[model samples]
Target chain A: MFDSHGFHQTAMAELAVAAQVSVGQIYRLFKSKEDIIEALVHDDADQWCGEMAEIQMRMDAGELTIVETFEQLLLHTIDEKDEALSFDILAESFRNAAVADTIGTMCQRFRTYIRYFACAANDKLSGEALDAAEEMILACLFGLGHRSLSRPRLSASSAARLTAEMIVTALGGVR
Target chain B: MFDSHGFHQTAMAELAVAAQVSVGQIYRLFKSKEDIIEALVHDDADQWCGEMAEIQMRMDAGELTIVETFEQLLLHTIDEKDEALSFDILAESFRNAAVADTIGTMCQRFRTYIRYFACAANDKLSGEALDAAEEMILACLFGLGHRSLSRPRLSASSAARLTAEMIVTALGGVR
Candidate 1:
């Protein structure tokens, strides 16, 4: 319902109907729409962290290059439903303090993972340089996901590979 | 109105109240909310193109380097309200085809501007390599705008400078 109608546009009644549950039941489980969105963001973050952990393990085991890990983790294909939900929540975050808090917390977790990758790729990258690199890469990853919305025919593979290379280059030119 | 309440959630009455015009007047001007949003996007894109054109003129006059042009054009500060409206429309574009077309056309114009920057930065960047570079740079620019929502404390200047350098490097190591 949120994906199709947007977060604010999806009324409790519409959500209840879509979920095949009573509005009362939803109220019992989630205090408000924001609460429901927070839960979804938390759940999604957990899954993403798990994927990052798996990739980190591969890197630890010497099975994946930094570029390969980025490809699998950040530069991977985006699911349309997930992308819509993420943008929905992100857009909502601008107006809702609580939603912003949730997104901020989730981004902090993601930042740590990105920092780990940066450190692994180049130990010399620390302080402001490291910070800039991480933010640049994060922005690139977020931007890549958004590209599909405007340029659907543009292949993700070449973009992904180039982004991965860019990350490698940005992180002290190591691949 | 759209920035705070969202596109789908904002009704004609609320918009009328906000605009200090009658709902009937709004109806006379715009057939629906989508029409209003299309007008806004078109207006925003025109302003963006004007800025790009000015930057291009500066680059042509040798008053600004390619890096400087990108810093001024793509990596400049993002207005919070504009950012929110963009994300709002981008999210809506996922579900609304008409909105998607508006965004797509705007992006095409922006893409041409990016291509010009890329070509000027590196004549060697051609065909698929050029396409990849443009998309990568576009994603980075978009991502930088979004970073403010999640991580407000991070300074954009360093990121912007680094991103400008990264673009130069990615375009073929010419600044």
Candidate 2:
């Protein structure tokens, strides 16, 4: 419901309609809109963790380079549903600590995965160096995701090329 | 109104109430909700262009490095209202050609500004090389902006340090 109508636009009545539940039933379960949002973020986080676990395997096997993984992540961020939900959660996180914690946890999970592969590739990429590189790569991924929305016509190939180069630079010229 | 409630959540009735006008008045001004959004995006683009002009002067005066300018831009993306509105507009652009055009124009303006400084710094940093650097820097800026939303406690100083380092790397170590 939040994905379809956005978190702010998804009123309890609308949610009840979408979920095939009585309004009274919703109140019986979730305390408020915030409560529903919190639960949703938790649910999404659990699923994302599952996805990350698989990605970790690929990272270890060298099935996909970090740049390729980031490209895929960026593309996911551009998805209409994913981007909207993410933007809403991120915007709400500014005012809601529960949401903030959820996002922070998700970010840490992603960074850990990236760091795992990055360290394996270059032993020197650790500590603050690792953190900085991860941050840059993540930022680039996030930026491209946002760009996907504003510029639907934005060339994925061009973005991919520049981002790959950026990842190399951030990784201290390791490819 | 879009900034506060997002594009979809901000209804005509609420806009009338906020703008101190009748719903009829709004309908007369804009044929539909899409028209209103289109107008808003275009108006915002004009204002953003003016800001870029000022930044260009500062760039010429050597008052701040491109990294510093980017830091300020990154921080603007972190602004609760600014980021929300931008995210909303960028998201809307995906579905609306008018919004997409406005955003493309806005992006071109910002890129031109960055290209000017970049070329002045490194005559070789023109064409594809400059385009690549600006894209990376913009992506980094955009990424940090989203980070600010997700991590409310993220320190500006730390973000600045990492981003400045990123700018140097993106410019091919041109600092």
Predicted model with the maximum lDDT: 1
Clashing pairs in 2: none
In model 1, the runs with Cα more than 4 Å from the true position are A173-175, B173-175
Residue pairs of candidate 1 with colliding backbone atoms: none
CAPRI tier for the interface of model 2: acceptable
Instruction: Determine which window of 10 residues in candidate 2 chain B has minimal summed lDDT.
Output: B148-157
TM-score per model (chain B): 0.91, 0.80
Q: Cα deviation of A138 in candidate 2 (Å)?
A: 2.5
The DockQ leader among the candidates is 1
RMSD of 1: 2.4
> Please, what are the lDDT tens digits per residue for candidate 1 over residues B122-172?
887777777777787777777887777668445667677766776676576
Residue B36 in candidate 2, Cα distance off native in Å: 5.5
